[model samples]
Target: MRGLFEGGRICEEFSAGYYGVCAVGGLISAGTTHLAITPFDVLKVHMQVNPVKYNSISTCFTTLLREQGPSAFWRGRGGKFFGYGIQGACRFGLYEYFKKVYSNLLVDQNRSTIFFLSSASAEVIANVALSPFEAVKVRVQAQPWFAKGLIDGFPKLYASEGLFGFYRGLVPLWGRNLPFSMIMFSTFEHSVNFLYRNVIQRRKEDCSKAQQLGVTCLAGYAAGSVGSIISNPADNIVASLYNRKASSLTLAVKKIGLMNLFTRSLSIRIMLVGPVVTLQWLFYDTIKVLSGLPTSGDDRTDVEQIRTT
Candidate 1:
């Protein structure tokens, strides 16, 4: 178990220790958090698709409970759990790898540039990995009759739309996620830096475990709120595409119109994303600790080295 956790034994030259720990942490944290919030996802999707029917979060919750029973909220949770698990692994692992690479290449190694470039790259990879499952998840969420879970959705989607169907919403998914990721990672990095140095009066690495966890959650929430606002339009379009089985991006945009896309259900989404992101970071950092690895924000030594070099 320790050997597996170390990850170095398997791949000695690949920053195995860092990659291994982060991959495991990211996978477990994101997958579990995503699944845990499956109910909110169901509400958010229904509300997004049919605002008149759902209206507000409280109403949406009760409506679903009354119509579909408690289990309905968890209808497609399995897809989210496994889908986000892969997405998280790629996101965190590749972000770190790219950051290090960019650090070595850039003469100044500015944190902002590294954060943006690395995160953008990571988001692209993560979204591609998440696309198929996302298609299924959205279908199930938008129309509860679509499929029961991952097992049913996969084959059903394949039979109906074939291979391309699984990736039907890939473009919108990328459009929605790219900015969100860019905003999220850059915001999270800077937020942690600000809170630790200015607010907490301690460097990130110098903080105690509880302090680190608190900082992670705060930074994650900040990132999630901003990211949600910036990406909500594309998010709306993506949901519509899946729910309506629409293909043309232009038509989707035309049908939704600009104002409707951003205005409908924005607050509910922000509320949903904020705590979900906070919990993901909290769980991710906790996993790091249990695995005997450094927390995500504790990169002072690396930053100093980059500055000197």
Candidate 2:
């Protein structure tokens, strides 16, 4: 296993093979972590779709347990795994690709702007792959009678609403994900830089693996928490639209209310998203290190050269 990963190191930086390795790492990181938290996702959907029924976190758990049994928590595992797996591949891989592309095009411009543009561009494509699975996942989790999982949910959704159904939430999905990705990537990059420069007072390469991964986790959590809050309203609207709580974005906002859209199920989301994002960065960087590559957000020298040129 170690040898297999180290083989990936032969790929030159920003090369196709390098991006492929990053994509595979992202697939494993996002798929597994998101799948692991299926229960929380189920609860979060329920809380957003029917806050009166699912109320508090504890209450939601008990109600789901009593009404639907333990299996209810894992309702959308199939969609969560496959959907996010593909999304992760595109997101992480393309972010790196576009980051380099943008750096070259916008030479000597703000690095933060590059970060924002790269992440935003990657997410636009990623969400297209994610929207259908998300549609099925939300439906399966929120409406138990809809279908068992992605296998059935896909066909059922298609049969009822055709291909359009799967993509109906694309706009809101983009709305939720674009800002989230921008914040996540830029914040993680800047946070990692800050930790190394101000707190650690050492070069990232000088830090031990454990210390470096610790920075990744802390930065990821900060990024996730902040992004979750900023994108919470759109997240709620996506949930509401998918579950038939609202027919359109306008109605979803009107029905869910502006305040509830931002606040509803937010704490649970932070709890869920914070660790998920942290683990994603941890797993992503761990794979890179194991593959003899440096962790992300550590290419200041190359970036500086690009900017100056």
Candidate 3:
């Protein structure tokens, strides 16, 4: 892996062109990972919305395969393939871009503040780009009978619900992602810093290629678990709203009820998210390395500790 990016230069300075590369790398890496995990996501949705039918992961897999065929596992992947591609690209690219911007503004260079603001800003932009496809994705997953895929779903949604339908769940989506990104990114940054300083006793820049990947996996899992648990409630609302269980936000919450909303599929999310996030960061960082760009979330204390001293 290191040999592939051996010619890659460490960016001592940020540039617009480099940011563009980061965006492209982010897009490809994120899109690939999300698409690859679509089957798991499909299973997760079933577990969330129709726990009785799905019950367990193994049961869901066999049920979908038996009833809907192999394609059933990827039922609504179109939206995720495209929507999350853009979301991943923006989330990563803008995160790096914003971190630079924020760091320049603050003398103390607080990692938590920078991570929160940058991740939050990126997520807002990413979710906007993601909403339409995400709406389509959720709808297709919840109502597998809705349409076969994006092509069918997009047209069908527009015809039945008009333009507003594509964005119906935007509020809940935002409600879910914002805090998720905040905790996820901030925790990831802190985790990386902690792991490198305390665990590895070395800065990120000094770590071997394999070491970097290991840290990313550990940090991603930790961040994903916390982020998913915190955001699952809003996530439930998004699923419910898009699935037609409720017409409005108030009704959606009312329909879901407090206990079910919070606890529904909480374990599934943590289990699913831990690996998904771990792999996402792994792919995202590896792509950056192969693309000759700076590693994601490596701009904090440990790296700075090496740079300043």
lDDT of 3 by residue, 272-307 (tens): 777878888988877667666545665355766756
In order, the Cα lDDT scores of the candidates are 0.81, 0.89, 0.81
Order of candidate numbers by lDDT, starting with the best: 2, 3, 1
Stretches of model 3 off by over 4 angstroms after superposition: 1-7, 10-13, 51-59, 303-309
Q: Considering lDDT, which of the candidate structures 1 and 3 is the better prediction for this target? A: 3
User: Which candidate tops lDDT?
Assistant: 2
Better of 2 and 3 by lDDT: 2
Error of 2 at 8 (Å): 7.6
Q: Estimate each model's TM-score.
A: 0.89, 0.94, 0.90
Q: What's the true lDDT of residue 69 in model 2?
A: 97
Task: TM-score winner between 1 and 3, please give it.
Answer: 3
Better of 2 and 3 by TM-score: 2
